[model samples]
Target: MRCYVVGGAVRDRLLGLPVSDHDWVVVGATVDDMLSRGFRAVGKDFPVFLHPRTHEEYALARTERKTGHGYKGFAFHASPDVTLEEDLARRDLTINAIAEDEHGSLVDPYGGQRDIAARVFRHVSPAFAEDPVRILRLARFAARFSDFVVAPETMALMRQMVDAGEVDHLVAERVWQEISRGLMSERPSRMIEVLRECGALARLLPEVDALFGVPQPAKYHPEVDTGAHLGLVLDAAARRGESLPVRFAALVHDLGKGETPEHILPHHYGHEGRGVALAEAVCERLRVPAECREVGVMTTREHGIVHQAMELRPATMAKLFARCDVLRRPERFEQMLAACACDFYGRPGYDMRDYPQIERLRVGMRAYVGVDAGAIARVLEDKSKIPQAVAEARAAAVADALRAA
Candidate 1:
């Protein structure tokens, strides 16, 4: 049996990148062959095993045939006859199809090394169209390797796949998984650009797709186009090394503006209220985790108010703090604020300007936290009045702090 290091580990190593995990392809090996060697069976659909010592994944060299829709519609054929070249041919990208043998001899049957040197993303074969998830993975790779451009043929093939309605069959979980990873990349906007270019954005995220042509007030958003503004926000979040929840919040924060009335023409008044529902809908549709959903929804609803932090009255600040449940969930509240900061910093001539609004809100939060709400509740004669009394005390404290500041 021949074992070779295949896929990302080889690709990353060839590119002088840090390799974290290694995937091995065992050619001319059967399940029994692996089992007898002390390897543990782990793969559900095909023949995959874990090394008894290193615990790394070892998948038997296999070939597949398209049997149905999406990524799940495939029939695998693994046997001692399967060649290393055949297994590499099934990979999505040429750059990922390279393999290395135990003697460190490199295998480049598909010109993966050439494509890597050229910084181009090319599909392995015509079989690339069989899996819809490849499009998302290509986009994510663009995000990570921001300098690489998709090959014209590959882009055309992906467009054809989208036109054929293949992308529509992708499972929501896979979509979320790929998109969330793309959002956290160093240049997340590249992922969005690739998706929009291939027409997958409209199919997967029509709300975000609509924002590309939408107009925004040029004074506040020097970028002028809401779609362009969204890209900037995502990149800004990435530049700041923000978390997944913060990045996700940055993604859907402006979706409400896409639904703005055309007569208003660049003025998105009341878009926040509209945005809350749209953001909530996206979170639900994607099955986004609770932390990400809460931050996204709250950022959508309160970012506009947050932008006007310096001008809001003490009562308004207190109400905003209470509504966001900042005291109970400080970390999430901070993530929402980080999302808002990205929105403000994403525009031209504003990217480096001071964001005093964040500090203003921080001052208010400190005052609100300083208020002894429990003490107020303890002294209240009527239990029902406790909430109102605590709110009054918090507001008064905020007012004093603001006045002092």
Candidate 2:
């Protein structure tokens, strides 16, 4: 049996990147051969095992044939006869198809190293069209390697796949997985652009797709198009090194503006409430995690209020903090504020502009977040007065912050 260090570990090593995980492809090896050698079986769909010592994944070299539609519709053939070149041919990108042997010999059957030198993302073979998830993978790779350009032929093939209705069959979980990774990439806007260009954005994220041509007030948004503004915000979030939840909130914070009636052209008066429902729909459809979804929803609903922090009355500011449940999840509240800050400075000329409203809200929340409503209730005979008394104290504290500011 011959084992080679293959896939990501080899690719990243060739590119001088830090290798996080290693995968091995065992050629001329059978299931029993692996089992007798102390490898533990772990793969459900194919022949994959874990090394008894290192616990790294070892997949048997195999070839596949398209049997149906979507990513999962495939019949696999694995045997001692399967060649290393055959297994590499089945990979999506040429740059990822390279492998290395134990003697430090590089296997470059598909010209992966040449493409890497040219900074091109090219497909390995015609079999690339068989899996719809490759489109998302390619986009994510584009985001991670921001300097690499997709080959024109590869882009044409992706367009053909989209036109053939293959992308529509992709499952929600895979879509979310790829999109979330793309969002956290070095240049997330490139992922959105690639998806939009291939028409997958409209199929998987229609709410976000609708924002492209929608107009916004030119004064507030120098970019004018709501979709363009979202891209800017997402890039800003990346530049800020913001967390995933904050990045996601920046991506969805302007969805309500997409639904604004044409009569209101420049002004999105009530977009926040409309945005809340759309954000919830997006979160539900993608099956986003609870922490991420909660911040997204809160940012969608209260970002406008947070934007006008300097103008809101102390009582209103206190109520907004209460509505957001900032006392319980202070970190999430900070994330929400960061998302709002991404919105404020994401525009063309406003990239470096200051939004002091964030610090004001932070200071104001710190002042009253410790107030105890239950403790105040004991001093008042009327139970309803307790809420009022706490509100008053919080408001007074916020008012002091406002005055200090």
For each candidate in turn, the TM-score is: 0.98, 0.96
Residues 11-104 of candidate 2 have per-residue lDDT tens digits of: 8888899998999999999999999999999998899999999999999999999999999999999999999999999999999999999998
Per-prediction RMSD in angstroms?
1.0, 1.4
Angstrom error at residue 230, model 2: 1.3
lDDT against the true structure, each candidate: 0.94, 0.91
The model with the greatest TM-score is 1
Candidate 2 off by > 4 Å? none
Candidate 2 TM-score, true structure as reference: 0.96
- In the predicted model 2, the residue pairs found to clash are none
What tens digits encode model 1's per-residue C-alpha lDDT throughout 272-376? 898988898888888999999999999999999999998999999999999999899978889999999999989988866999988888888999999987888
Q: Which candidate number would show the highest lDDT if scored against the true structure?
A: 1
How does residue 147 of candidate 2 score in lDDT? 91
